[model samples]
Target: MRYLFAEYVFDTDRRELHRGADVVSVAPQVFDLIDYLIRNRERVVSKDDLIKTIWNGRSVSDAALTTRLNAARVAIGDSGDEQRFIKTLQRKGFRFVGAVREAKEPAEAIVADDQVEVQKVDLALPDRPSIAVLPFENMSGEPEQEYFAEGMVEEIITALSRFKSLFVIARHSTFTFKGKAVDIKEIGRRLGVRYVLEGSVRKASGKVRIAGQLIDAVTGAHLWAERFERDLADVFALQDEVAVAVVSAIQPKMIQTEIEVATRRRPENLTAYDLFLRSMQQYYLTTRESLAEAIRLAHCALDLDPRFGSAAALAGDCHASNVALGYTNDPQFDRKEAVRLARLALRIGDDDPDILSRVAVILAGMVGDSEAEIELADRAVALNPNSWRTWNNRGWVYTMAGLPEEAILSFERAIRMSPVDPLLHMTFLGIAHALIALRRFDEAIVALKRALRHNPSFLPACRGLASAFAHLGRDVEARAAAARVLEIDPSFTISAHIARSPKSPKLFIEGLRKAGLPE
Candidate 1:
């Protein structure tokens, strides 16, 4: 792949940089950095992201990173001050601001074999985990079942798209493969996804049978396969059921597979969707460093596709998390920026439950916009009631609004829907926080402990535990919890926390003050 920008041509296949017939002598790391920045020019690249990509996640000092970035700029006839090609964003990262065009390699005919090599595709893979649902094969004798099969595949695509975690190809793109014989490996390569879902829809008499298989597109390994037999009377309902079952069955598989692949590639080779998936994987850690990296990755995704609502929502989410957990001392600036991102996401993805839920949680929890948060939360629930994230977000809004009863109910519903969710720690923390508002110190302590058990480093749980323990007169435990909070986020101060948490009631704030957090 060749990228041309300004007077330079970067040959990714040759691993060379050229400017007006002059080959630039760049260090391996510098070349990788420039390549990454150019390939992902759609977003900002952070120092942490640089270390992860160029140094393979090794520790690198700020001065060293700055020097290397400077070297990269010099090699490309650019500089930090000039920023003709690379622009820096304060408290964010760096973006390749130069206009670029990708030159495609000539396409070759794809061979359908066990060892498949796909011809180059025009579209790049997304930064998030992506899957293409090929149009379901119509196996029934009657050709009239074509719409039934197409409808089922389209429904599945729509259902999968609701998951902020997975990137689902649109029906129009996937349907292009309808009635065609294609190689799974080629499909995987062309789609730039690790997994693919394919199935057959059969309607016989009054009954319907849907058989689906989830394949690891990279290795042609069958991760899962399922068949459902249901009444054909309610076609849409059956489609919904099959879609839900496929998503539930394959979600865990996709996560595990992505984790294995996460460390195998550099940013230069990743698509916008791949970057988004990487961001989400890191975001789940919920640590200060991880949040920074996640935010940077999310921004990179947005750069590749600025209108991506999920990426915008996650970017806002990271900003909100930064202030909510006291990761930053500058609450006002972070709050303003976070609200701006959330508003953009809301406008772009008004109907997307994933975006709506994230925006609602951030606006309600960090910005303290009760009306907007509540309305969005309600809309998210109505859009996808089965989504645990939607329920979890709604609970957050209620907790922030000081409605303990409603908050507790919403959290419980979220837990019921996704009992083993990695983020269950968050729901437990919400219940604990709400319990504190209700003056149930003992119950709150138990819930906080449970949350800590799931994720010991979760700062919100630690802070809540401290408050609950103090309210219960367990001074020793309270001090221990407060110490843990400091350990996770040394910048944490009661004043900063209070400023960010606009929805917290007076009683809840009082408990934290009693718990020995510095004002």
Candidate 2:
């Protein structure tokens, strides 16, 4: 690849330089350094970026990088004294100043076999476009609360995933770089994403504090950031409050992005409501113990304000979790309680997307009412088209209904809206299942691999991959994959589980059988 400058050409493939027909030979490292500079010519290429990219994350002395840069300058017919080709910023990085143009290509076609690349969808970038919600750092100094922080990120991921107009990265992909110091541009390239959100969370002395910032990944520029401090007594309100603020911040940034007047209504006071937000955060933990705490806090929120739609919705969510996780001995009683709370939430906040979505999840997942679930999900999406969770929930409904193609599109849209959510690995699994049903075995395998890349422990993805390989006549790999799935969830019985869902189609079962599952 030749990067063009006014009179100079940096040939990446040839590892050579050309200045108006004159060949300039430079050290390999020097050529790489020059090429890097030219490719990112519009902005400053920080030393950290150069070291990471050029050295492949290896440690290299700053003096060595400086030497190669100087050598590059000389080869380009520029002197350090004149400083015309490259400009070094004080305490920052380097920039290429010269204009570039392409040189001649050698007509040799060299193809490598081991390179497997997925073709990206060709879609127009939406106005006020992309975003990333970074994992909120746990400032509470309690490592155990890492789940709390992670839960917050997940909620944000779900909330944002609803927006069809915004592009969001899957949470699993973003969290892969968690705790590591990374350059924003590199994140953009690796994830093929454009925006990033970073933040920190602190809980101490009965209060929770959160600080967050949104950045343009391509330019490493800060677009928005804010800090919120609230009492832990109102913890359940935190996620929704934060989500609302984020949605507010993102709208103005999007091209022709307008916020609806009806959606802008705010509670008179949020002190009690804040506790509800914090409680809802705990609810997403989806564990037996956490559900107890979530239910307790949600009731406390109702005590504060019976009309609080968010708290009511969270109460419903807690109940749904109990049934989903098999926490209750009486499935019928548990489901009744879930349906009751969900219906109450809908009655109180029928127009609220978050509440509508919670009710829809219960209807689809617990009640097995796909038609009603789809109706609610569609309404929620229409109300808050920017919420990723809404789309994700809709995808689940489609999958349960055996509409794999519709499910695949819904999941894809959810990923585009909030690509960084950890649960998105399941979305990939859903896509694989859909592809298998469509008899597109190769595409199914690719989607499964992508799911594994995001979450190696995702059992559904493992099962899907095994089934895909088996269908493709790769029995050994298929058996190995199925074995892994069984290891993860020993009680996993494909036939029994499929039978439980009335909407499971014969086509889907056939595809799974071809993939190697035992009848």
Candidate 3:
């Protein structure tokens, strides 16, 4: 998004301030302050708002705040005395008084009412996630409901566009086929999107029903579909719910499709994304062999693209997983390597929520830096609140940091975001850990059972149930759970588990000991 005002273009996407044909040098804080003021130009912005936003809620001196504000003024060729572009209301707040207009991203534009312009061209799919939300058919016989259906598609498009991972095509391009009977695959080709969402909205007697489905454009397959019915009161709220539901479902489905495509690709045709996807598929299996293979694939991805932060972060996470699962023979070496890869990922992948989330968990568990890692975890969530993987990784980070209560909340949010995500069993295991830490054995047992139901061979969940049952004094059930663990992994031992999972709470290990597990 670019803001145009007074011979200056503030390019928010590129984080640049340009004047006509020249680039303007400005500090990061100054840029943020300017951007905030311009975005909220219709209202006043208090000092408290600036401090909370720019300083991340840290207190800042009045003098320091003034310095940053003044720097912003100079960058845009305005002055405190002139106050032409920015206005400071004494004892009140600041506002961007300048006239400002926003320009949509190039090749994207909104459609005006009663306007429909078809476009024709061949386009290549972008490297990142991309989608086109075609205007929904207004199945209602009433012409007024046409507005509702169009507005709902716009809401969904805006919601999806918020995630940094997605590339949403302009509404102008999509609305051309608004009333036309068109093929989904052809729309996908013209818009160059991997996925497309289409649906119909019906409004009658003060109630609205919407049905939406996401399609894998490449394979012409239905990836997800849902129906929603809501009251007409608070129409915006209903639209928001529909958007959230659709966005949440679309995200995980798109990634799963991509992962499957990558896994099926020939080795010689593998790109960095394919290797990374392959690694993620292996990483989630959570078995010793799979985790090792995930690590190998991650390293192979790094070899192809050393600056691939997601790949590097995945490698670091695999190391942490190895230590947690008792798969690594050299604990110290794994720790050191995890730390190294985490830092490298932090450097190269600062803008990516996935990398930040993975590195946060690795550092929280291995480096033992709870405060900093928690902040990093929060940053990841802040970067992309809609991403379930970030929230899931936050759960593990908080669990390892010994903040079990927070861990459970993060895990639950992740499941709510994408209930059928392939990594959902891992999230259930996280919830079980948090419950055990809280000494809620019954709840822990319930969570473990859920995890096992999802993946019966999931050793961690089985082991968790054994420990939880033992602590609850259900000796027979505890022994059965222990026997099941052994059945799953014949070489299991409490001593090795303790050595590998150094971050495990003492109570959990003690429960395992009481369960009569081999040591």
Instruction: Name the top TM-score candidate.
Output: 3
TM-score of each: 0.61, 0.45, 0.76
- Please report, as a residue range, the 10-residue window in candidate 2 with the lowest summed lDDT: 111-120
After superposition of all CA atoms, the RMSD between model 2 and the true structure is 25.1
Which ranges in model 3 have alpha carbons more than 4 Å from their true place?
1-119
lDDT of each: 0.77, 0.66, 0.82
Clashing pairs in 3: none
Better of 1 and 2 by lDDT: 1
lDDT of 1 by residue, 43-76 (tens): 7788788889989999889899888889988887
Total clashing pairs for each candidate: 12, 48, 0
Local distance difference test, candidate 2: 0.66
Candidate 3, after superposition: displacement of residue 451 in Å?
A: 0.6
- Cα misplacement distance, residue 318 of candidate 2 (Å): 5.4
Cα lDDT for residue 169, model 3? 66
